[model samples]
Target chain A: MSEQLATVTGLYGLLAEFREPEQVVAAARAARSAGYRRLDAYSPQPVEGLAEAIGHRTSRVALLVLVGGVVGCLSGFALQYWTMGVAYPINVAGRPLNSWPAWVPVMFELTVLCGALAAVLGMLGLNGLPMPYHPLFHVRRFEAATRNRFFLCIEARDPLFDREATQSFLERQKPLEVYEVPW
Target chain B: MTPPDHVATQAAAHSSVQPPDAPPPVLEPGHTLSTVTDKISSIVLTAPPPRSWYFGLAISFALVMLLMWTITQLLWRGVGIWGINIPVGWGFDIVNFVWWIGIGHAGTLISAILLLLRQTWRTSINRFAEAMTLFAVACAGLYPLLHMGRPWFFYWLIPYPNTMGLWPQFRSPLVWDVFAVSTYASVSLLFWYVGLIPDLATLRDRSRHRLGRKVYGMLAMGWRGSALHWHRYETAYLLLAGLATPLVISVHTVVSFDFAVGQVPGWHTTIFPPYFVAGAIFSGFAMVVTLAVPLRAVYGLQDFITERHLDNMAKIMLATGWIVAYGYAMEAFLSWYSGSPPEEYVLVNRMFGPYRYQYWALLACNIAVPQLMWSRTVRRTGWMLFIVSILINVGMWQERYIIVVTSLHRDFLPSSWGMYHGTKWDWSMFAGTIGLFLALLFVFLRLLPMISIFEMRTLVEEEKHVHGGHSDTSDPRGPAP
Candidate 1:
């Protein structure tokens, strides 16, 4: 990775790599406690408390899905009512045109449908996905972040990210490699 | 950089989590993260598939061709080509539609319902089953569309403004079917693809070919497996499972409502919804077993999809099979208890009428045969479970046929009471959907990691354990090619 970077590039941050998930967890905790507010951990699998160590301990996806479901259900019912009862009402078997009982099935379906769409899209939107180019990709060993390696990166944007001091700080935490991430 | 052998922590991460008498690990004990990734991705990235894959794909594609031919002819000739008439308005079209959709339920149950139940073993097989669900729904959706004489006017089911100021009657279960089936398909796809993103990222990183990297990269949506992202991912995934639980139960309930609302004697029973749901799970688990047995063998993935998976699935099938059997008993009792001649006649007609053999065969397939699974030997053996699953599949199809035909074949007017038999087009259409299902499955297996790689990674106690050496440049595996 270092060999591939012959041209001068701006620094994005320092990336500390670890072989095991525990090491990355420990490093992320240490970095967070040391006042690095902007940092992220990458792992091959979900570590039980890794996100908490990096300061993200709560999620709003469930609430978003709830709201989406209610809205979807109401709109579904409205659509049925407007169409069947108001817009194109045709009497059948002398039955009332406002057949609310029959509307429950479509409403239930729409609620699940819209709420699920929110669940996926909201999560992805919050995570800033489809971001094809990131500074982490510049570091070749980072590819293993999807495989077996664990990584904790202290971004340059962090208030306390001092390059030399953070390098030494990560070294003390005992990682496999501490590499400079290029922008 | 530290040396290859620093501090190791060889046994620290694992070894203490398991009790002495716990069953075998869901994943076999020795797999590390690298090996799991290697084993799953290798199907697409390294090793070519076995010759049997080509053979299966060929047959499925040919079936797809048959389906296309039948659909073409049906479209040209309208619904009249099938044996459907006034008395038997629904034949193989509705039967296959119901059967295929019912078969889809097990996948969601496995992926979403089992996940909510905190069943850890679902980690291995849920991905492919969900794929099966989507494909089955796809197959189910085609029938109702083709059944429409003017297939192009299918959009009339949707509540949209058209030139004629026409709107679909929202009070109809058929319209509800439109929304339910479409929603099921969309949500199943979302769940499946959301689960796939991280693994797709793994493939994108590991793929050696440039085109593979580009294609997988685009599909991955640039997933980096960040901790924050994983948190939101898990959050969204759990919410989806929560939503899908009721949705899956509701899907079959609505399908049964399509029949239960009818004035037909056999179709109007109140037990239809729960009975239909139970029968759905029964057939769905059977289909899962049918597919999983060969898949586990062909991939040599005994480690991931272990014997316990088969055992648990067989147990579920047994339980659901009893529910189905109970539904059958209730149907009979209700007919006699109601004391209505039409209701009693529907029951007697199913038993001794023109379709008595079909009823008996359905009993043998769904009830009598699944009873064999009570033996430990049958549940444990792959071939035996496979055989039972195939039988159950056939039995469930027969169940639908009897329900659809026997009820409609006898009306209040004996003059209109006539038997229904599927014509060539109907038979071909049914067979073609099976081909369509298999063809989609074949494509899915080739393109994606059928087993969820990231989920499998989570199963291991210590993912960081390298097999023979460390990862990265210093590894003894010769610098990762």
Candidate 2:
């Protein structure tokens, strides 16, 4: 069963370690130029131009927040209007049933509330987070990526992925080491 | 590998690119990325609690017990247990409520607003400040519930489905508060949690104990430092900050509305929104300093929470303290200029009324003591700043007491006017919340990475960029167009 599982997951990628962010970035750029599209880089901290080099820049979280905010704003106003104007219309100082002024505070609160919620949830969803398992965790040295090292991984799923060629290509970038990441 | 001296030279050259007026160093000198991770994570992951932590915890837990006793007595007796009367309906309860809520603002300002402004110094303090916001808000939240008289019926504030088919009065600022405070607490929690993720991952990775790793791993949600993940994380964080910025402004404005909407001479003022917001930030920064000064000492976190952090925080307190001073001046000016006999009377009463000492004390602490912060020596001296912070907090509490009690104790109808004096219950509840806040803080320090490891790592990386010509490849998003 374990062997079957390994075959199913197989060798997911060739992971390369670079001593510096510049090295990994240059390697990413080089790989991109070499027409490798299914590549990702990791660094201890954000390295400029690396994301663009590996080509995964745009995020929809902002747009999601906007939608959430609009929904919240409308819902907030609607809730107040439905309750005060329509549902239970009690006269308070002869004020109009549709008291738009009083509704503003709750509306603003909900807008911020929903917008923030969507931002966090959208980020996690887009990143596919809460994912405890990844093929890279199987690599003993991959932990350094969170500490000080830089890494670039070319996934086996890439149409152009040939293990030997990918390994040789990564080696030419003068990376610290290269290893296969097993799923 | 590059020679260590060469790397140093590059970093020194990079420092030149920083604007001459750039703020003081965030992290102490000579910290490598590995060392930074080790130092911060070690506090939670490895080190045993110091004697001070236990001493502080014991005191805090005692206070928590006192708080529980007070609540039990109050619940058994009633709101009569408080010093609040018909004329002074909102006494220490409302005073502490507003004071705590105000103290929460600095955290959001530091974490959300400073992040938006690209102030890197915030990195050092944001984690701590955000945690402060949550705990402070927790303390603030207890007041309105307890003050409701029927604390269990607090759910009536929500517009939930009911057999009577009733809804919370949307027109009331009290109801507005229900939304504002809850939303503020929720968003702050989310913002704090989201910020903790990467740091939690750091802790998860660094923990040698099986239990520590498992706990941190669950909290980290399997973060693997993927660039793609960081990209989305940054965007979400920026969005949350943007959302929270308006919130920090709005929450206090709504809190102010609780008074401003009233017809009382002192309570109804156009300036309340900005005035209250400034006071909130003022008190909140002071509270941050009060917590941070001792915390840095006890934990030996000077390397990360650095002298620069205290200096900058003191400067913030001074700036906001001026704003608060301005608020006082404006309130008095508006009262006199308007020539409303009642407004003029209220202002005069605040100056010479029965609680006149409190008003003066407020000025002494909030306005006068903070003036010392103008001198660089006072701002740089941690103990001096700590003392000033304590004074500011006292002054702020007095400010709220004056606002709530002075305004309510004497209204337009002199016949109904009555003075307020806090009972033991009032002091107990206040002291209890303080204990609860401290106890929660102690636990937080023991478990979480109080200093944001990833952000400090980023700061280190940026510094390296300066020295190494690594700036070119530092931000993939490219230089701002």
Among these predicted structures, which one has the highest DockQ? 1
DockQ by candidate, in order? 0.75, 0.72
Reproduced native contacts, each prediction: 0.90, 0.77
lDDT of each candidate versus the true structure:
0.89, 0.89
Docking model 1 quality class: medium
Per-residue CA lDDT of model 2 for B280-382, tens digit only, reads 9999999999998998888888877877888888988888888889989988998899888988998899999888999999999998899898887788778
lDDT of 1 by residue, B282-311 (tens): 999999999999998998889899878888
Cα RMSD for candidate 1?
A: 7.1
Compose the digit string of candidate 2's lDDT tens values, residues A86-180: 88999978978998998999999999999999999999998888998888989989888778788999988777788688889999999999999
For candidate 1 chain B, the 10 contiguous residues with the lowest summed lDDT are B472-481
Lowest-sum lDDT 10-residue window in model 2 chain A: A1-10
Which pairs clash inside model 2?
A48-B473, A48-B474, A48-B475, A48-B476, A49-B475, A49-B476, B10-B467, B11-B467, B14-B466
Share of reference contacts kept by candidate 1: 0.90
Q: Which stretches of candidate 2 lie over 4 Å from their true place?
A: A1-9, B1-23, B469-481
